[model samples]
Target: MMCFRQVTLSLILLLLGQATPSRLQSLGATKLRLVGPGSRPEEGRLEVLHNGQWGTVCDDNFALQEATVACRQLGFESALTWAHSAKYGQGEGPIWLDNVRCVGTESSLDQCSSNGWGISDCSHSEDIGVVCHPQRQRGYVSERVSNALGPQGRRLEEVRLKPILASAKRRNPVTEGAVEVKYEGQWRQVCDQGWTMNNSRVVCGMLGFPSQQPINSHYYRKVWNLKMKDPKSRLNSLTKKNSFWVHRVTCLGTEPHMASCQVQVSPARGKLRPACPGGMHAVVSCVPGPRFRPQKAKPPRRKDSWAQQEPKVRLRSGAQVGEGRIEVLMHHQWGTVCDHRWDLISASVVCRQLGFGSAREALFGAQLGQGLGPIHLSEVRCRGYERTLSDCRALEGSQNGCQHENDAAVRCNVPSMGFQNQVRLAGGRRPEEGVVEVQVEVNGIRRWGAVCSDHWGLTEAMVACRQLGLGFASHAIKDTWYWQGTPGAGEVVLSGVRCSGTELALQQCQRHGPVHCSHGAGRFSAGVSCTDSAPDLVMNAQLVQETAYLEDRPLSQLYCAHEENCLSKSADLMDWPYGYRRLLRFSSQIYNLGRADFRPKTGRHSWIWHQCHMHYHSIEVFTHYDLLTVNGSKVAEGHKASFCLEDTNCPTGLQRRYACANFGEQGVTVGCWDTYRHDIDCQWVDITDVGPGDYIFQVVVNPKFEVAESDFSNNMMQCRCKYDGHRVWLHNCHTGDSYRANAELSLEQEQRLRNNLI
Candidate 1:
């Protein structure tokens, strides 16, 4: 009947054309189900195929919430509502239903449900089956499982199941050997046929032998040949073994459990021996020590013996021939002394050799020459008292390879005391041959003249007199009147001069001269006289006092007088209160001094007013005018004086008051003048607002002179007058006539007048 049943079943399957079994039916073993906290959808299905059969859970009280939880357990994304009436397809097996409800917190469907079966409100048509599709798989667990099993088997089992022997082929089935090991706490035999000496050595090293040490004497050839039987045989063989013991053995050299000097046995068959003695014939494993060779030592360095030689001296400056130190240029190269031994004594020797005064400093480092060679000379010793080059140990007259350009630099100082005597005067009497008579012209007129003799020649004496501020006399006479010689014979002849000698030569004098002269005995006397015809002497004048005022008030004042005028008979002309005045027509008798009357008597000349006097705090003088000689007599006429009143006594009343001069108008007017008791008491009228014209500033010098009521002529008092602030001559004026007169003002003067008015 069983056979008939099998035949019918097979035929039925064939008639149905079902050649292959269904996937669900192919799973005939128990399947593993994955349910965890981190599971999510899309990974597909919680249960995997084992012994094939499909079953459904009975979700008796199942709700959408419970279905969502089951879906999550099956590795789905957040669930939709549960499908009640077989929304997918009808399942073939019995449905498992029970009390089921799930909060979202459940780790698995079984944990969330009240019963073992998945209970929900699902009919048999809608069986509670699962589809797990987690978002990611735990790959670490898979890796660990694979590592534990390995590709062939566990790494430990490769040797633990059988003993490894040197004679066994790598591809052959392994057998137990005499060597044993404790792996995972169990004694095992090494697979002898598959293991090599290298593998044995690795195993032995893991058993605690220093693998880097020498192992040339430790390995036995006979022990490695022991044949491996079963695990029991390996144990029996180890019972009488007397070699080292190890816990583990490996065929691979990298195995960490291998011992360097240990015995192993197969654990698949039996236990190992309890007490194995040493030195017995057993299969001991070991790792050979690493090979190493020691390196040899080197010899010491040689000492430099050339540096111990005695000292020598080398170079000197300005020496003739070979009197200097010996300098050796080695290998076409130059060097200098280190200066370590250079001192004053050595320097003195070098100076004497060079024919210089003395040695101030010994310069090193090629200061004056190109130090191009090896430095052979080191220490130099010398006493400064050595007189000559040969008397010292300064390497004199020694032949050297040094070139002239490669000599070390040296410098010396020459004494200044030797040059003093050579520059002095020769007999000191002043030579008499080089006398020169200088004739000077100033403003086209001679102002100085003189004769010089001996070393006090005309040129030198003129220079000396000019230095003394005394110009040579005009018209130098070389006849018996002034000199015994003819003109320019033995004495110098000069003419037409005017000078105030203040220069190194008469040519530097500033005025015309040659007017008069005198003579004396032994001294060869000469005298200077004012040439009344010379323009320089005729126009001689100077400022006595200069004062400045601000706001019509005097600020500060000064007095200047020529030094020559302070020392002569004309010094009395500087006395105060002197008065002088003149008036003439515009076309009067003016004289132009002729050229012959102003010839140069000496090299140079100057003219100066011998004295200066200040009266009424101001004075007026004309700079541009011809000197007039009326009726062939010398006199000044038709001149104007431009001047300003400046004194410390002027009243300072207001900020706008000021004193100024209009030079273009040939006149001046005092503005913002402060009236004082003295000015009013003297009947000096305030003319601040007077129009442009000619007027006189009168002052009553004598108190007795007074205006009378009866006589018009007696009412007016005439006084000696001086014009102030740019003056012009008035041709006509009477004793009683009003002084006012019409006059034209220049453009510059007009502008100034307008500014003062504003």
Candidate 2:
């Protein structure tokens, strides 16, 4: 049936001769294929389908963003880096895409902002090739993230919250809002007709909620109607059009997804936007389980807020109720706990203390997303039965070299729902890596086949690897033509698989109700290369804090910095030889705390040489130093430019293997650090532009994520800044995963809120 459908669509498209690849996919045509050199499966000169003919993409303005779109369009995790000037080889066709600009998360090349199809100002010599990693290679598997892959069916593939009266985090199940369904790439409102509390229960469960509550729909209606009146709606610059879909859903309240429930759709659904009565949208309010209640001072044995003897703890950024990044309270501020010495036993204590049952998975390395503020506790050793983390043996400060990216998180619950069995890998020599195969129902016949490669991103591969018991996905492979997989697994059976990267299995990932692989299964079948471990890069927050100071740099000595755009925008107007630039100088020491080494994505053979710096730079833009206002806007930025990685310091037992002096192999070895001292050129943020009262001076490592690491949360370091014209004071320098104390005013507001919350 699928083949016949494809053939019929092909004939129709042949007759039209103007259909787009995305349009053809929507019509269920044969999957789009990027024809290129076949020697390297991970990278090739890219071609695109345009106006019924295949063509190449010009390298004009092609960079990481464009490369990412090309790689993702081919269904890989992300682009490591893109090659210009025909690195893979020139092609023999018209350039289809040029001046292609993308933010890197578009669903397809068609969706990204670009020049019109087949419109380019270049020839074949300017063709671009993209290198994609199917599963990400930059991340390491620090801890096993095991979550119950709950009951899932095609019926409830995705259910999202649409806020009316209040705002809620889009994917956080702990919040509440109206319910909507995703269909054919558009999020459509579910008709309120025949909707019941039982239906709400099913929607909530699909969103990882435990139960439902009464919604103030009338208030929501009032706020929703008043939305256009006031453009400043708190719900993320509100203004959403309504398109009602699928009326009359009946649930038994026990069905895991809405699949088992009876659904009644009108035959005239195609006519008049017509099906729902009164055009009312379905709304839901759910009770966040005990584990998900916003953090407070509540302890296991305390009824009083003032009795805070054990301190307080809470979770953040969890997909499900009992799962999240762990945060503890100390010294009247929120902070994170280090993952060193953390395990299931440690997670269980946090769970039980928070009134959650027990721990099912002890996640690590900011899997749920890193926290904010200080890392108050390190080397936490918890017994299975500890009443509180304080009752367990633990360190009180950040002396163990643990960074915020290594912050420990947890998923506390009962046994998993057996999602691991629903997904498998084949064609790889080892069990950990392969072309991914997942079980799904086609025409009511259950079978396993390769997934369509469309929007299969880092989060999607993470879920697949987790389900397969692979520690982490180092690459999301789209070129499966090279793999020798199981005989029957080449058939494409799934499409539009979108995951939050926090799902336990492929079953929990949302997909099209009908199979819709844009590039049908075979050659572009979804694949992943898994790893039990990968390198972890952490910026030395302590070093940044200790080395913080101010400098007055003369413009005469900043010709190279000016060439690199390392100085502020005001520098372009500055008087050349007479002016001085105020710089916030700080040393950066990045440590590799993971089991593997951190290497540049591109090899030294391909490194770019800069005449100004007189050195071969490994990464294009490795780090970003920004001076942000209290509300988070860049007031100034660093004079930093292209960087080279090498070990500058290590413990007694570890030997240094990399140096930039002679263009030697460069990498930050495990248990070692690579330092760019404060006195080095381009190591300072040029802050001469403004009179700043308070600001956030932040440094982020691997900001573009061209390479893999264990945790990204700690890659960013932020410090509170106070400046009076002559000098600047830097304090509370915390990693992204650590919580910096709020400004004094916000701190006071926090105390009142905490008191009221308690």
Candidate 3:
């Protein structure tokens, strides 16, 4: 009776417990969940709720202090240990935090300092996790979080740009690669369906690049087909068996990551299937910005006997540090290397020894001025893998027939930060034509400095034009003294710049060294006149066949033609009427199909005065006409040298704006044509000497390749011709590459002609 009464009193006291929540639960912080392959609730990868979704924290800077806070938040008494490198298992979704810092006294992990939500430079291998103590409060219970808040969809983990061949890794990093995406703890490929520049931009951005570039998938496919032992195998190894994880990704090209774009996964087809029926997988090419370089290891010192040789290399007389005669310190005496077998590979070793990039130009013949010392070494042969000039194989003495005048010189790439973005152009009539300037930061002070004008040429201007996105360079000027009042007048910062015309930026060009110009020399800085586009001169294919005829002229009328070699060589030896010479005449219409004017590269100072045309002609030899056998043997040729290039006629909706009289502007303007009529003096392919059966008439424009054009392929036109001593007929005339579909027909016709059956 007494125990029953006490139990009743205890039940009454228990029912009167405090109505307020416990202080632990009263913090108003959301609880974190332990998730992964681990079965126990106390162990697994740690995850927290953010933006109504779950994300993992990067284990970059995680430790026991942060793990203690994580354990307490998950209702554990303390954290026993922290798991790094995804010890439990890799987590999906976003990596919420990185480089996290926390004190053990923190009540929750949220109170710690981190790299902010969903931002990390970590891979899945750096996932943070924690193992908590096996004890909990008596009344506490673990509850599994429901997936209703966020869908159980897979998140993109990593983006890998797989190259077609492992050997091509050093050639181009982003231009040639098969794109792969990571999902569901496995790396999978994306189908090429609807894969446009927009999709590529997003992927490139996710890979930390600025923009997308075009990839030559066809070229890669051709190369891959040649490499594959069994190409007919239905699976594409480039796409990794077409195991696509995502398809139909739509992006406006503004997304920072692929996840931010609107994605449709297996909408038209199922996963692990061929989403692209063409059997081609998705490929992404990115234009890497300035910061997209891999972190390179420091160059290691050699461990061999030659390692003790100190104070080894130096450059001399170069305006820049890297542009100099390569000299070696041997027995405390500075001596130069001979130019025998001296190449870029040998020069690159010298450049690297001076703490610079590869050699831009390996100059010989004392190009950087003669070194006063003895030529110490000769026949230096390097595979371009050596770290220093001493590592290369060479003759020890002057036995290799070397001299001081044959000293090797090198121009090395500039080693400077902010080189790409700090460059600018100023001091020209147009923004595209200007003096080059760069912002120099010295002791934390910023000021604009000019590039020295010495040795400035078109090759250096090509790099500057490409870096500015202004297309090819028209003219590279060595001095801007004429434009003295321009805004680019400043102190000189760079000198002795030499470029190969292939670099994407001027900074990639080889330089002498640092900014070491005499004061006020920047006023006459280097300048360039850049053209947005260059002309592409193509021959008119239809006109060649339409104007085909045989011209037999008398001796008096053939005087001009004979002098210019428009007629055959037999005409000079033959009687009057040139023995009824069979001349194959044709009209050549050269069209300017590019955006800018097709001007000769030479300036007014170089223009040749033509007495016959009574005009100063910029180009002396513009076109060549030839008649050849089907076996590629030339029977006769006609050369047209002088041309008054002008826009006599234009395409629809365009005007003939340029003329030779102005002299201010030259070249065939865009949308215009300079026509050399069939009746012109030298427009005939002289077939007068032979009894022509079947022939191929070819016309080549810009034959010398003197001026730079956008393309050179379209400059030639060929046609099938038949001549029987008196009359000639032309058919199947076409420009380069346009007649590929009819190649079989031409081959069959040639076979018939060879058998005398045509």
Which candidate number maximizes lDDT? Answer: 2
TM-score of each: 0.16, 0.49, 0.38
lDDT score, candidate 1, position 111: 55
**Is candidate 1 or 3 superior in TM-score?**
3
List runs of model 3 lying over 4 Å from the truth: 1-201, 205-464, 476-528, 565-581, 601-616, 659-667, 739-758
| Candidate 3 per-residue C-alpha lDDT over 250-301 given as tens digits, one digit per residue, 9 for 90 to 100 | 6656333354345545422233445455535578765443323333622223
**TM-score of candidate 2 relative to the true fold:** 0.49
Give the candidate number with the greatest TM-score. Answer: 2
Taking the tens digit of each residue's C-alpha lDDT, what string does model 2 give over 498-610?
88655667877788887776677678888888776666677878788888888998889999878878888888998897889998898988888665788887787888888
Candidate 1 lDDT by residue in tens digits, 296-345? 31211211111122112333221211122234322222234433234333
Rank ordering of all candidates by TM-score, starting from the highest: 2, 3, 1
Whole-structure CA lDDT of model 2: 0.65
| Stretches of candidate 2 exceeding 4 Å from the true structure | 1-387, 391-414, 452-456, 478-481, 484-500, 506-525, 569-580, 639-642, 740-758
Local distance difference test scores for all models: 0.28, 0.65, 0.62
| TM-score for candidate 1, residues paired by index | 0.16
